[model samples]
Target: MTRDISGQIAVVTGGAQGIGLAVLRKLVAAGARVASWDANAALNETVMAGEDALALPCDVSDFASVQAALDATVDRLGPPAILVNSAGIAGPNMPVADYPPEYWARIVAVNLTGTFHVNRAVVPGMHEAGYGRILNIASIAGKEGNPNACAYSASKAGVIGFTKSLGKELADMDIAVNCVTPAAARTPIFDQMSKAHIEYMLSKIPRQRFLEVEEAAEMILWTVSPANSFTTGAVFDLSGGRATY
Candidate 1:
């Protein structure tokens, strides 16, 4: 339970709700000065209003928005020593042939390109500080390739690959860059998925249940903690026996 991230500055993207919010709350409880960045301005303000945390409006898909949020975070809480890149979207599920091109592009923009933008913006500060931890949230679909959710699966796959490449690039530093491939959690993201698609995902999980955000957060907290110093460019599996490799 000792996260060893006390007094650190941490940023959790998509922190207004779901897994991001879960991780943000955990970081604060572990004594980190936390910033919650999300595109939902009103929801973010409302959710973070009661907590001792900074809530910033950020559209991760846009580099300018990501940059502004980073600047505000640094100005207010100092450079982030920990980053949880949880901002993502689950585009509507459909067969690859029926999926709209626009939807595919948008999903990639947020889930893949957005990961790159946030990581790219934060790394320089971490490099200068000579210490940092980063955890990018990916999905089991990225590894196994889920049916009817081609965009989400593909975008998450990109996250896995990006995490590996960036983690290796910064391996010489004290920074640890890693990713988690989680089984589907019953979050608001499920709202974008069809009932059949959701059922399909659950059936694939040998645990026979959806993942809990808190369960995911617990693993994420440690993965981004100072204790995780030796591991980088690795993928942590949170798939509840669903991941074979």
Candidate 2:
């Protein structure tokens, strides 16, 4: 069932394209005003073109940047009732032993620390509003572990832990904190991984196909919907039956 969100405010990180953009468009269509927070300044400048939507440049990896972006968002749109942390990178594909130390640092900074940043920045405002929904986009790799992708896997696992812990923190409130773990999807993030790494992911999906970005968006839409009450600290699986835990 479609939940009513006629007067809701939303913020979607990485909203410039891919899954974030998918979610942003769906929210707009559902009558919710949206802010597209992305690191791509160009995308933010040109992607959204109307009164109900605006784009703000934000690098989720940077706490200071995340804070500034959050402030700017609240100033432009009202306090966001919904926040989707979709900004992330796959990092370079390599075994943990061969992974570049610097690259590993970068991936965790964005995938894990960044998730924390978005949630920390948004939660206070949500607490003040007495209502909120936070959706973290994790991956199946976080659960089953993936070879040649140490940093990506570890960081996502951290996201799952964080989501679960935070969900419980706000369990008594109207706020909901949850995460969705998806199998590989053909997003631009694929540009960063090796062909072997990509194939490895495809071979693992029992469905014999990669997930579509829109399908991920649909799950995100519901996770952040008002109808999603009574569910927090939960992990919604979208791994083609790869994960039912």
Candidate 3:
């Protein structure tokens, strides 16, 4: 029998644009009602245009802010049975010694701690409901450290470790937790990286191309679907052949 997600309520963090927006669209198309949380105000208008999505402004790095957003979502959309932790930031790239401490802290707060906040907020509802899917978006840099992106790489590596630990803790429950490690995808974050960094990422991929937003989002949708019952605490790779191990 095939699993269908119709009538499910899905919460997608950072669902303003790029891969996050793409995931929001796919989940809605799969018949799930979606609540999209983004820090950018424009995202609300962009994602809610002619769709059934609820767009809420949320700062994932702040627990109070994330809690408020989740509360609002539940009030408007009901309990979220599915979650995708896609909200992240790529801090300024520089050698470790040259990197600003503020930048490093910001990267860790948004990429790693932010994921923690969302998961903490939503997991209780899943536990109460006895079913859920949680997917975190990580990076290939998390697996294979990048030269000048120390903070970004470290934060993502933390996400991977956190996902594994939480997945094990909830193994006996009906909820499944997993993450995806994707290579460079064309998004606004690319503009923050140096041209050399972008070129290096492309060169590392045997496919010689950056991944499409839709391609990444498709994998996320599948991992969060009921079809993904057996693969908790696993990492899915989408590196265009650059991922090894």
Candidate 4:
């Protein structure tokens, strides 16, 4: 049965812009009450004006922040049945030998640990409701390690592992935990990368073009929909024909 997510509450981290905002828009159009959880208050408010999306200030890297955000979201929008972990950072491009310790820590904090924090906060609600959908935004760099991106690759790899384990643990339940690995999209995230790095990513894509945020968001919506029943502990590929597997 196709799940019409009408009236279901959804929380999208990093919903201020990029793929997160795109997903937020789609979910709202699908009849879901959506919350835009992001650290960027100004941008979030700006984007959510007429969209009617609740804007919540959340720093996913911090467990306290995540818990508070989830609490606030539930109080305002009702318990979220859909959770999308799209908040992440692409550390500066550099060889592993020259990678900054601080960058490595921040990358892992926001990308890997952040995923853990949000899931921890929301899963209990889903468990109670006996239905839930989670989608983590991973990266193609994790599958085929990028040359100058060790922190990003490692952190994303951890996200993949975490999703797999969480999905398996929840397979017996109605909650579905899965992640998607997408090739580079022309989001503000690209501002963190170097020209060389961007060109390298483009050269690798058989499609020879960057991904669109709308394209990525559509698959994510479907992944979290009721139609996706029985597909858990899996990785969905959106790598522009780059992933060999």
Candidate 5:
């Protein structure tokens, strides 16, 4: 039960708000020195100002930005021993046929490719340190595709695949790479969704409610903790009984 990450350097993408911010708060409470990498630099700075954390302006979709953020984190808090890929966006909700091509590209770029960028940038340091825990934020939609959210669902599916592949590649080491498939949480991401889409999501959950950010954070913290020594290339579900698999 002692999932302490004390003294560990942690990096959380999209740590400015929502699930990412929740995870960052928990990491700090667990005694980890966390660097919050967010594209919303101003909001990140404002929110991280009072916490015992670092806010780094980073757009995870860009490898250059990811590298710079990693450099800054290493210089400030040493190589991150824990990484939580929480940076993501829920693109406009619409049927696949109606989904804008541009929106699809943007969604994948930020959600799927962005996860790759951050992981790629941080793993080397963890490898050198001989210790690391990576937790990627996937979605229940990835498992049971949401009806009008093709891009979001597809991108999250890619995250699950990416996590599994990376986890296997690093299984021989102390590093453990894993991801979580969470049901819809009522966060800022909701603003991008239509009212009917939100209702549809809520109805799909057996719990008949949305996921809580803190609940998501708790699972995320543990997944990236030292206690998660054996589990790798696995998907932890926070889907409220919505995911059959």
Candidate 6:
């Protein structure tokens, strides 16, 4: 039996565009009030369209900034029972030895530590409510390391590990923590990479195409729904046949 998510409040980090926006739209369509936090204020407004949504500017890389944003979100929409950790940064393409230290740290901070901040802030509420759903947005690179994207790969790997560990810790609780490993998608974040790098990524996928944003969101919806009561510490694969393990 599938569970309905009506009237549930969901918070999505990086909810301004791409997969995040897709998730927000789906949640709203399913009768869930949604809040979107993004560093780009304009993008957030454009995505939300002044609906029953709060578009807040947030730098997920900074714990203090994320905490304040979470606080504001609670004040506006009440404590989020569902959280989607989608905020991330794809750093420069380079080998591990040649990757800039600052770039590596930035990627880790945004993709990994940023997830930590949001989870830390929201988990307490879920624990108190005795119901919560956390769906983390990881990447295929996290499962199968890419050649020239060490920082992004490592950060996502960290997310997978963190999700697994935390999921175990909360296994006995009502909170179900899971993550998805998606292949490259046609999002604005791709613009940060070189054409050659993009081509290289595409060629590696057996499906020979990027995963659609809608598809990713659909999976997220199911994972965070009340129907997903039995699963925790699970990693769903969206890698376009690129995932081996």
**Which residue pairs of candidate 3 clash?**
none
Ranked by TM-score, the better of candidates 2 and 6 is 2
Poorest lDDT segment (10 consecutive residues) of candidate 5: 45-54
Residue-level lDDT tens digits of model 5 in 6-73: 98888999999999999999998888999999999999987665344789999989999999999988
Runs in model 5 lying further than 4 Å from the true structure = 50-52
lDDT leader = 1
State the TM-score for model 2. Answer: 0.97
| Clash counts for all predictions | 0, 0, 0, 0, 0, 0
What lDDT would candidate 3 get against the real structure? 0.90
Q: How should the candidates be ordered by lDDT, best one leading?
A: 1, 4, 5, 2, 3, 6
| Residue 229, candidate 6: C-alpha displacement in angstroms | 0.5
Query: Residue-wise lDDT of candidate 1 within 1-245, one digit each (tens)?
Result: 34588889999999999999999989988989998889999999876653446899999999999999999999888899999999999999789889999999999999999999999999999999999999999999899899888999999999999999999999999999999999999999999889999999999899999999999999999999988979999999999999968
How much lDDT does each candidate structure score? 0.93, 0.91, 0.90, 0.92, 0.91, 0.90
Candidate 3 lDDT at 56 equals 89
lDDT of 4 by residue, 131-202 (tens): 999999999998889999999999999999999999998999989999999999999999999999999999
Model 2 clashing residue pairs (backbone): none
Give the TM-score comparing model 3 with the true structure, all chains together.
0.97
All models, RMSD in angstroms? 1.4, 1.1, 1.2, 1.2, 1.3, 1.2
Q: In model 3, where is the ten-residue run with the lowest total lDDT?
A: 43-52
